[model samples]
Each structure stands twice: as C-alpha cells, then as structure tokens.
Target: MLQKVPKQYLAQTRNIFHCNCKIKIPIEFSEELLERAFEVLEEIDLKYNSYVSGSYFSCINENRGNWTPIDQDCVEMIRMIKKVSLITKGHYDITCMPLLQLWGFYKENNHSLPKKDELATALEKVNFRSIAIEGLNVKIGAEQEIITGSFIKAFAVDKTIAFLKSHGVADAIINAGGSTISSLNDASHTAWKINIPDALSKDVFKTGLQINSQTFSLSGSIDNNLLIDGKKYGHILDCITGYPAENLQTGVLTKSAFLGDVLSTALFTVPATIRDEVIAELKQHFDFDYFIIDNDHKKIVTECFQYLR
Candidate 1:
C-alpha cells in the first residue's frame, strides 16, 4: 500500500507511469516560489519527454544517420552518461533502442522472447560506443538509435534541482518516480529527514539514507512488472544479452543521481566472475558507494556504509 504524503504532487503530464513527484521546502518561501518549481516540471514535460515522438532526442533516433544537432544541455547529459558508462564497464547503455522496440515496453504490448536471430541483428545496430558527440554535434551509426531510458530519470532530478536553486530556493527535496535529489538542512541549517524504503518490503525504511546536498538514485528489480506466466520480468535489461538481468538487483548512491542510475543498471548486468573487478574500478574512478542484493536476497553494503545498521 503506497500512500501519498502531504508533500506529494502527481500529475499525468508525462508518459503513463505515475510520476510520484514530491517536494519540500522551508515554510518561509512564498507561493510564487512553489509555483516556479511547478513550472519547471511542466517545462521539462514539454521538452526532453520520451512519450513525444518529435522530441529532440527522438528525432535524432528517427534520423539515425544524419548529423543530428543537439542543444548544449542534451550534449552535456550525453557526455556525462558516456563517462559513467565507462566506469560501469558497459553494464548500462542508452543505445539499446532497437532491442527496446522489439520487447514492446514503450507501447505496453505483450512481452515475448525475441527470436535469437532478430535480437542479434538488433544488438548489432545497438552500441553506445557508436554514438559520438563533438561539441554540439551528435553522430550515430546509420543503423543505430539513441535511447536515454537509463539516464533520463536521474537527469530530470538534476535539472529540477538546478531550476529550484536558480530561483533562490536553496533548501529543498525533489523526488520523482523513486529517483531523488536534494539539499537537506533548511536555509538555517535544520536537517531534513528522509526514509529509505526497505528493498524487501515497502512497509517503511528501516533507517535514513541521508544527504545534505547531493543526488541519490536507486535501481532494482524487486519492484517491476514483468509478469509473464506467473514469473516476473524486470525493466532493467542487460545490454550484453539483450534480455532482462536475472537473480541479482543493485542500488547505488552517489553524489550524482545520473551516475548512480548508470551504475545500478550496469552492475546488474555484470557477470558474477567480474563483479569484484567492476567494484574495484568504481572505487578507483569516483567516490561511489553501493548496496548489492545478492542472488540469495542478502544485503551487502559497501565499505563506506558499515555504520548504517
């Protein structure tokens, strides 16, 4: 039973999935301040929207071979996504558009196991490495299309926070569809308390996953709708297999929600033999922290989180 709290405001402006958006700011702010925040969400709905076939990114996908030009914001986002993909060792990729179309997740159609030959062909056309950005110019292989399903949610949080900060609202929390970004501690330094939901159950978060001014993103299969023949199928797909990852689910918390989103998606696809190496690489590149739910449903926290319990 997921209940809405006072700070929650949901609108169906985006795609069909309920965007459980929440925001909380100090009481000192005026009505105009809150209105500005709402406007930011609506503005994002018009641009960067996945449902609209004519969006900037969508048009790039349609004209796959053309030198599709992109705005600075979109370019910056793609650049950051690429950097994170490198750190994740290709576990998460945004260039799986062909495979996504075959699976029919976007159109709410029945899920079927794609033919081996067909999926292989789709995979051939789907490689993030093929898409390159040069300043504001975007280039992709003639057969490939770009899809930002993995990064868009977290990016939205980033953009929303920027909008809020620009309006002089220094203290706030924005949670959109389970992805969150925030500057806790009110304008006067009072802390904000947030509940981190238990992965096993939605009853309540056992303890808080705190942040003063940072981004946090969680990706897991425990809460997905891939029910086929009484078995569940998750939304996170393995770019390697062109199939949903099985057995393990992962959650990553980082200074940037965009990176967390990629790591969670990528780590889920890493084969058991190389998971340790991937973790080691993450440690080397960025100050990242993670919690992995193993095949046996055991929770293993990274070295940075030993005191959470």
Candidate 2:
C-alpha cells in the first residue's frame, strides 16, 4: 500500500478526452477505489456532458414543456451556473448552446460568421431567464435547456478530489486535461508545480503554478482554436454574442478552476470597457485571484497570485 509507483490511464471520449493525464494516486488506492474513481469520472462526463444527446440537459431539451427535475448533483451545478451568471451579469451564461452550435466549435464544420439578422434570430432563442429551478425540480421554458457539460471540468476536479480524499488519497493531484486540482498530506514534501503553455507559443512554456495548499482551477484559449477569414478564434464562447472569444489571449490562476475556467471564457468575450468592473466583481464575490493575458500577451496578476508562484 505504501508503494511509490503511480498508475496512469487515458480516457478515450470526454471533451478533452484526447488529452492525456498523469494521475498521481497513492498505491494504497485499492482496486475498488480505482474502479470507483474511474466510474466517478465517467459519470461526470456522462451526466454533465453537452455533446452527448442523452445527457440530462439534452434530455430536458428534448422533453421541453414536460419539465424534469434533476437529481442533487445537477441541482448543485445549476446553482453555481446561476450564481456565476449573475456575477458575470449574464456574460457567463450556460445556455449559449444555440450560439455555440451555430459557430460549430464542437461540430468542426467551420461555418462563417452569421449574418446580423441570423445572429439576432439565434440570440432570441438564447436566454438564461427561460430556465426555472425550484429545489429538486427544474423546468425549462418551451424553448430552453441547460447545458453545463463544459462547466463540469472544475466540478469534476472538486468531486474527484472529494472522492480521492474519501478513498484515503491524502497526497494526490488530479489533472483532468489542463484543469488541475490537488490535496496535500502533512508528510508529502513537494509542491505541485504545473507549467502552463505560452499564450503566444505552445512550443515555449509561459508560466508556472506552484501550489502549497488549496484548490485552484484555470481555463485559457491559448491552444484550442480555429482560423476563419484570417482571424483566429478561441474555444471560449461569449455567452452574450454567442461567438468564440477573441479579445483575451489567455487566462491563468484562479481560486477554483471551476469558476476560473468559466470566467476565463467569459473574460474573453467581455468588452474592454467593462473588464475593470468584472475584475472588481470577481474579487468581491469569490475572493478569487486571477492572472489575465490580454490580446497583446501582457500578464496581469491579482494580489494573491504571488502565492501561486
């Protein structure tokens, strides 16, 4: 049980399923514990995934007017979705699927920008207000469904960390794709240091995150992208305009990558005029620290980012 060797597995079909992860679970992780961890990760992928047609959100959309109340796990995720939506003033909405599908980020069909009239039409179908949730029961209006599959990475990290800890994984780190979460035991000697890719170049390393304690989540658009009409498009969608984020090149460092990943995506779509206000709001609500990389690739670090170093 005290062995130093670690086991590594690559999931074949999640969003970043193509991206491999090096899991540093303890040797004491029993066969049952390992199976449970895999099952938990798979469930997170299945229940929260947006691309899957049979997923909860997709099921709700298919059943529209019938109205189905999700289980507790979904309720919790929706709660955060609503909270973050309000904090971002609707810029971080989860109901941006219409716009997301129209743009073809998942489909990879690479459609051109929609005409103003077309965009306006799609925008009509996009509204977070259409979703109504009361305790265990959630109802979707005639035209809306909740999609938080993308939102689940951080949640998965949180849930996975909880699972690992419950299974006696005291000193462990779960790196699901680029999202990283870790817990340290008093006896563990090393800090978890993760290196982020450069905002400008993947060939070069940009910065390092060294965590002594606490949960951290991060999302950025340095790598995931497409080029249309000579303009580059990042995977982070603008919930307001329903288009890929183009302004912010990369975002790193946050209190919860769960929120950080969502914010990083939201920040990409936010207008320059309101960024200062957004930053202030983030600092006020979550006590989260951030490091934002602008279009020019300049780094802006919050007060607590020093701890990440």
Candidate 3:
C-alpha cells in the first residue's frame, strides 16, 4: 500500500562550486534519482568551472585571442549573459575578472587595494562586448578573462530542477550556497518559505517570503568580503569603477535561476537614482521583481515584489 504521508529526502554536499549545496524533495523518490541529480551538478562543475585545470572555461581564458570551439550549451549560456550585460549597460560583466583579481578577490589572505594604474589597466579589459561568438566558436580580446561565479551554480540548479520535473517529481527546492535557490512546487505543496536576512544586522531576519516554482537570488556586500585596514571590500565589483559596489544588498526573483543570479549581481552595482529605469527596461524582456537595500539602509522595491508576513 502507498504511504499516507510523503517522505522527505534531503541531500547536501560541499564539493560542487566550493559551497554547501542542498536539495530537498518532499516526496518519495528513489535514491538513484537523487544521486543522479547531484551527478548533474558535479558534471556542470567539471565541465565549466574555471578553477578546474583544462576545463572548457579555463581553456577559453587561457587562449583569449584565439577562437575556441564550444558546445551549443556554452553558446546559449554566453548569449544569455551578453544579453543581460547589454541591458544593464555593462554594469554586470563576465569579463570583470581582471578587476576581481586586481582587488585580490580571487586570493586568500592577500587582499590589497589596487593603485590607479593597475585599476585603469584592469578596466580596459572588463568589457563584455569584447566577447565575440560566431557559430560554435567563441573568443575574447587579448588579456581578457571571464568568471562564471555569478550565475554558473544557479544555472546548474535550474538544470537539476528540469531533470527532477522530467522524472515526475514536483515538490523540490535546491539551495546553492544560501545565495541562489530554485524551487518546484506542485498544487500539493503551494510554496516554499524563505527567510530574508537584514543586511545591516547579523542574526536578524526581517521577513519571510514564499516562493512557488521560482528562483530567489540574493547578493550582498557583507558576505564574502575582505577587510583591508578596517575598510570592507565586497567581492561584487563595478566594471566601470574597478572597485567594489557600494550597495548593501540586492534580491531578485525570477522564473530562471540563471537570470535571478545574474540580475541580482547586476542590480547591486546599479546606482539607486536610476535603478527604476533599469528595472523598467529589464521588465520588457523578462518577468521578475527586485528589492534592494542601499548603503543608507533604505529599502527600494518594485511594485510587483511580493512578500509574506
């Protein structure tokens, strides 16, 4: 006989994307299926993780001036990233690795401020428009580099959610390092409850939000930051300024986890005065809402932003 209550399966691992990833399915599922889902995540990590030696992404960075052959999936992902970059007016760029490295973000215990000349040189190679894609071949300008830290993990989660849905699984939530979360809930489970943390305060949750079959991505200046001489420097850098963005936090909700991840990072760098204009322009191409906390702790949210008390 079928069990009256559904069994929940929760799995977690810290190997993929160098972060703690968790997936919860509140329905009876085979262990093999669960393992396959994690395998999917690992497969993505192996193929495109730039940190991995000889990976596709690393190869592209290695041969910056030469065209490299890429698969269809790579082409699509790059195209999507370019589209968002165009819409955001270069506020979010995958080619900002030069600036990231200049600020010592990619290193441990070696964070240092860059000199004026160093910052200028890094900014010269930070243009996303320089990434050229032709057919199955892609190339970047010389001295240019691409970093997938912003959206690659979320992209993997979206792929896993699609896989789960294909196998008749309905109620599931995948959390990638507490930064990106993608969910699939059926009528049986209407939504997943998520807590929103206060950006200025530690150990404080401001509110709880409910998400249904959507992705929630949060980018904050407080997390994964470096302190140099008592000044906090966040990992999210502004491509134009060649410095860390000043926004405290930005949150985005979208149907695609990839989009959510990219948008959240982009929004964090956008200035508050013109943020509404950027959001309006984005709405024309995508369906999403956002909330941002500025440096002054002022809350800015779109009219369509939904929150549950």
Candidate 4:
C-alpha cells in the first residue's frame, strides 16, 4: 500500500553511493520509504562496487585467470557492458581499471602520469575481449580489471528508482552529481527542465530540456579532465591507444540509465572517423537522443534532442 505524504512533506536525502558520488533522491519523506531507498543503495555498493574489497568486480580482478561466480544482476550489467563495448569497437570498455590507474584517476590525491614504458605495459592488459561472461560467471585476463567508473553510478540510480516506483513512489527525480538524471515521472508531472552545459565555454543557455520516463547522461572532458602541463587530457581513455580520448563532450537521453551511461562514454571515446557508424549500429538496439561536441568543437545535436526542447 502506498502511504501518501502530504504535499507539505516533500523532502530529499543525499548519500555517497558507488564511485564516491553523492546520490540525491527526492522523495515524499516517509521514514520507511527513505530507509528502503538507502537499503537499495547499500545493496548495490556491497555487491557491485569495484572499489569495495570483497565486491564481485574486485574478486574478478584479483582472480583474473579463474572464473568468478557473479549474481544474475551482475550478469545483466556485464552483458550490457559487453554489448556497448562491442558496438563501439572497444572504445567503451569495462576492462579499464589498468588504464585509469596508469592515468592517475584510479587513485586519490595522485597527479602523476605514466612513463612511456609503463603506459605500454598497462595498455598490453587492456582489452574488452579479455572479459568473458557466461551465465553467472565472469573471467578476465591475467591482469585485466573491469572498472565501472562510467556506469556504476547510473546503475545504482536506475535500481533505486525501480525500488521507489515499486513502492508507489512515482513522480521523483534521481540526480547524481548533475551528470546522470533518472525520473519516474516528469518533475511533478511537468517537463523536467534542464540547462545543457556548454563543454568549452561553460555557458548555460535558456533553452533547456523537458524530459520524461528517461535517464539523461552527459559526458565531457572539461568536467573531469586532467590538466597535464599545458595539455588537456580527458579522463576517458581509448582502449586501443591507451591514451586519453580526444576532445569531446556528449549527452544522451535514453530509457535506461545503464544505456545512457555506456552510450555517453562510448560517444566520447569512439574515433571520430567512424563514430556515426557506431551510432548507427547502436540504433538497432536503442533509438536515443544525443548532443555531441566533436574535436573541432562542432556540435552535433540530433533531431531527437531538439524535439525535447
């Protein structure tokens, strides 16, 4: 049964979910419902967070050569990850922990860059094909690790929204650090307005978004890029080159936060020469809305995005 909170009782809480990002879920302020939301967050962190010592991803990394048992939920996540990696030509890889470590993003308070030799060594172990998932089992290469830096937070929000909706808690929003947004319904049954941030100049425009039944994800080098010397390097690295991806920023609105997360990263990392083909291939699985700024600062705003405005 749904306990309806009075209109005056609307509230929200923030907590550190997976990836150390705060998850803000707006609710009707029922104590039991609030606790249930926290429980969902806790469950996801314990089972799938790679940073956690005993999590399934950690177990898979520590025992790379051996097949590690995974839960069905983990299996579903991996399957989606594999599909994204494949269609993007390995640009959107889950086996990216080594690359992150080499680039100094994996560790806190570290600003070191890897030497050429060290970069080469790490690149040798980075490949999506190295990860094999069958049923509830997963195996990686001897040194490969799957890092969900791009997807885990969104996954957590998606699941939390699912839990809320099941409890008759509709018409809410889940925002994770202003990057991923999940909605059970439009903001109070109105268009969920959003201002698309400009990647280069950091300007905000008046024409925002009106979203419904969707999760929106935006990826860019500016938000989380590394400034090494005079060079700007994106946190997103190419699984093939083992280097930071080219200058790019992209936004995707889709039915699933998992898909939006993967697609946004993939769009940012995939080679520009063949990006359209990859997007075309992705369409067979999902038709989505996107906003992309290319290396030349050329904005590619799809029709789907314009229609939302």
Candidate 5:
C-alpha cells in the first residue's frame, strides 16, 4: 500500500496539492519556512485550480472563444503543457475536460458511464489544438476547457520546491497527491527511496528506486474504476476511441515533474504506435525508466525500463 515517508523526516501540510504534501530539508526549517510553503500553495491553488468556479482557469474556460487575459504563470504552464502535448502527438491532451465530463470524471460527476453517442458528442469538444495562446492572451474553442488535474498539483510541488530553494533551503522531497513526486539535494542517504506500486496487483511494488534530482510520476485509473460482469475498467480513456485505455497504469521518471505527470497519464492511454516516439523524446532530455501494465495484465518491458525484481 502507499505510505508516506516517516513523519519525522518531513515538515508536513495539507490541502497543499489538493492533498497532503511535504517538504523535507536536510535540516529543520523555522516556522517562517513552513509559512512560506503554505503561501506558495495558496498562490498556485488560486491560479491553476480548474474546479473552482471563479478561479483564473475557470474564467479562462468560461470565456471560451474569446481572448482572455491570463497570468504569466498560466502562460508558462500552458506552454509546458502544450509542449508535452506536441511531443506526445495529442496523446497528452489538455483539452480533455469534455471527454472527462462525459465519463463522469468531471467536477459535476453523475457516476454513470456515458452512451456511445454521448461520448462521440463529447469528443467533438476535445481537441488540444483548440487552445490558442498568443503571448499573455489565451482562447479555447467554444465549450472547451483545459483541465490541469493531470499536472497542476505536480506543478505546485515543483513551484514549492523552487520557493524553498530560493530561501536558501536545499535537500527536500515533495509528493503531490501521491502521484507527482520530486526530490532535491540528498539528505541522509545517497539518494531518495521510492516504490512503484505494482500496477497489476494490490499493495505491492516490485520495483523501487534510489535517486536524487529527479521526479517520479504514476498514473493509474484503478481507483473509482468500473466493475461490470466481473470485468474491470480503468478510468483513463483513449483519446481516439472514447473508450477506457487498455493499459491498467503507467509510471515514469524524469527531471520535470510536469513532464513525468503528463507522460504517465498519456502513456497509459495512447497506443504503442506513438509510445516509442514519446519515450525517445523523454530519453533525449533525461535518463528515465517506465513500467506499463496492459489490459492483459502483462508488463511491457523496454530497454530503458528495468524491473526492480
């Protein structure tokens, strides 16, 4: 099962990454440092949160098809997300809000699977290219909303770590909602230790890593998954098919938390035809490994991926 690093090693806080998050410094921080961390969380939550009806992101979506002024942070964040979408060849789509809504994965969820025609209708509004960004102004296609649930929390953690470093703090780790994770300079050990939970089994991770200066991300739809006639269905939907992806889950490591976050999500859904290209793009930027479990409950291995077992 997933567990936190021992409490003794982390200065903890809640609702920071839409969940509990931590910052571990080699040495302890003063109350001031903790306060600063919370401040960072508030800033990110205000700007990037997609669920809040009045958040900046909401307004951006609410003003779809018009040139909406946005914060500089959104510009950078949008650029980063768009870059990943490009590299993944639409596999990492930011404009999947309508598709998510159809599947009852949006804020106003009905918890019922959508009909085929309903899903096809929803897919009409799902296009990453619909997002138009020109300098500080942004626009989306009518009825389009860019959902950042895939990486906003991860971005927040990355920002928090930068904030801490600016304060002359080093040696820290951040876990965002138990998915996006990042670590800084080493503390007690030569590297940080993390486990990639077994995608095909319960409460187990055959592989764990010792690393520093890297981010790890896991995307799995097992939680809140569908069960029908003793068969299971994950929540991740294929962008092309409007159906649940065949892969049960995917895990990846990279230098950018945002990239790791996007990779895990996209790789879990997209077909193998585009998998190598995305993996190659990642390898060009950082040393990485991946683990993918398909619907057949078989692990797909690659030269770049080594099993811990």
Candidate 6:
C-alpha cells in the first residue's frame, strides 16, 4: 500500500485592482473553486474600482453633491471607512482623490508636485466629514471624490477567504499586489511566511513575518512615487497637508484584511509622536499589531508582532 500525499494548488490573476494577485491552497482544490475565488475579486473590481468608468464608486464620484442610490454593500463599506476616518481624525480619507489629482498621480506624463496654492485648493475638498449616507443612498461634497485604492483589494481578499472557508479549506493564503495578504485556517500549515523588503531596495529583505489565520497589509512609498526635478514624491498623500506623507513604510497585522489595509495607510500618514496613541485608541476597537519605518529609517514594532527572522 502506498501512502497518500497532499497536493497543492495555486491560482493567479493580474486584472484585479491593477495588480498581480495569487491564491495558494495546501490541499488539492477543484478548479471551479479557484475560479469562484477569482470571481469574487472580479465582482469587487467591477463594483468598487474607482477607475472603472461605470463602477458603483465611479457613479458616486460622478454624482458628487447629489444623492445617489447604492447597494447595501456599498453603504456598509462607506460606514466602515467613515469609522476609521473618525478614529484616525481624518488622516485616512477616501476624498483625497482631489489631492492625488493635484499631484498628478493619476496622470502618466504630469508627475510634478503641486504648487502651494494648488495643494491648498485641493485640501478644501479632501474631507471625510463631507461624505453622507442616507440609508441606501450616498453623497459627497461638491468637487469631492472617493478612491478605493487603499482598501478595496483587501476587502475583496477577505470576501474570498470567507468563501474559501465556507468550502472547508483548511489552509490557504491570498496575496494581493504584494501589499495586502490574507490567510484562511492555518491548522494544517502552521503559518505563512511573508518577507518585508527594504523601502529603498526591493531585493533586500528587512525582516520576515509569520501569520496564521491573519491578514498583513503593508503601505509604502518606495515603488509607487513620482520623480520630478530629481526629487521623489510619494503617492500616499496626507489629507490635511495635501502632500505626501513622510513615513516610508508601514505594516499592519489584523484578523480582518480590510482593517489592516485601512490602518496601514492611516498609520503611514500619522505623525510618529502620536502614532502610538492613535494605535492605542484603535486597539480599543480592533485587535492588531503594527510596525513603522519612519522617514529617518527607524524601525518600530509592536511587542506582539511575530518575526520569523
């Protein structure tokens, strides 16, 4: 008699959220299951992707200042985003789309930093408080727009994880764009190992993390930035200042990938002096750990963060 060997299966797609996504399962899974997981991602992209012309988010953006009917899911997503915005004191705002455009982040050829007046003008429209929800309808301040780039991918990953778990997946991992990663039950595979790269050097590994049934979201300015007049400007802008945040990198680990994604981005924009205080306030509502690589290249980590190396 021969011993049975466990089989692994992998699925990958590049169209979701404009980044390469991958899912790996330790146990042999049906192709239909894999396709269904990818379908989850595609549905999210179609509904919430702000760049898509006819997406629900795009519709909301296009009708700013006017109430627009939205699905229950969209209403819930906005509520979650608002809760985080209130907790972060508006540091993490979806209405920062104006600021992104001011910095020419959405355009390929215009990569210059915004002028002071331009930044100030853009700042006027970047307020989370301006977003309103009326039951299944939503509205934003005039000239204000929402961008789901920060957490939509992670939300999709979370949905996929739930879908996989419903099918009895014992061990699985989903990696979204090398930034947001989520895992299902790790009972079969002890933990998933993830590498943290140097902010300036992609080939160098700064540290590694071990996550079990958790999600890790990393926010960094190294690879996504604009170079103008020999000066590099990051894409993650501060909603208050209408300028790029000073933090070079931020990582968050949480049970919910959506929470991790929003927290990582919010932490990146927060000043270092009060970051711990903000984390403390957030911990009151959610359980998570974080690390920050400041502008000075200082590494700060929470006590509970699991390090593999």
lDDT of 2 by residue, 212-265 (tens): 545555556656676678877777776776666556553445545466566666
- Badly placed stretches (over 4 Å) of model 1 are 1-18, 107-111, 186-188, 200-204, 307-309
C-alpha TM-scores of all predictions: 0.84, 0.84, 0.93, 0.88, 0.86, 0.93
Give each model's whole-structure lDDT.
0.67, 0.64, 0.85, 0.77, 0.74, 0.85
Candidate 6 local lDDT, 1-309, one digit each (tens):
998764556665666798889988654678788888899899888878888888889999999999988899888888888887888777789899888887887788774567888888888888999899999999999899999999889989988899999898878899998899887765556688888777787678977888889998999998788898888888998787777889988899999999899989988988876777887888898888888888998878887654421
Candidate 2: where is the Cα deviation over 4 Å? 1-19, 181-188, 249-257, 306-309
- lDDT, model 1, position 235: 72
Worst 10 residues of 5 by lDDT: 104-113
What value of lDDT does candidate 3 attain over all alpha carbons?
Answer: 0.85
Model 5 segments beyond 4 Å from truth?
A: 1-10, 106-113, 186-189, 228-230, 281-288, 301-305
- Candidate 4: which pairs clash? none
Off by over 4 Å in 4: 1-9, 18-29, 107-115, 186-188, 201-207, 307-309
Clashing pairs for model 6 are: none
Comparing 1 and 5 on lDDT, the stronger one: 5
Per-residue lDDT for 1-309 in model 3, tens only?
Answer: 976764556565655898889888644688788889999898888888777778778889999999998888888989988988888778889999888888887687864679999999889989999999999989999999999999889989989999999999898889888789888988887688887778866368978678899999999976688899889988898786888888998899999998899999998988766677878888898888888888887788876454421
What global local distance difference test value does model 4 have? 0.77
Clashing pairs in 1: 91-266, 92-266, 226-233
- Give the root-mean-square deviation of each candidate in angstroms: 5.1, 4.1, 2.6, 4.3, 4.6, 2.2
Q: Total backbone clashes of model 4?
A: 0
By summed lDDT, which 10 consecutive residues of candidate 3 come out lowest?
300-309
- Candidate 1 yields a Cα-based lDDT of 0.67
- lDDT of candidate 4 at residue 189, scale 0 to 100: 65
State in Å the error of residue 218, model 3. 0.7
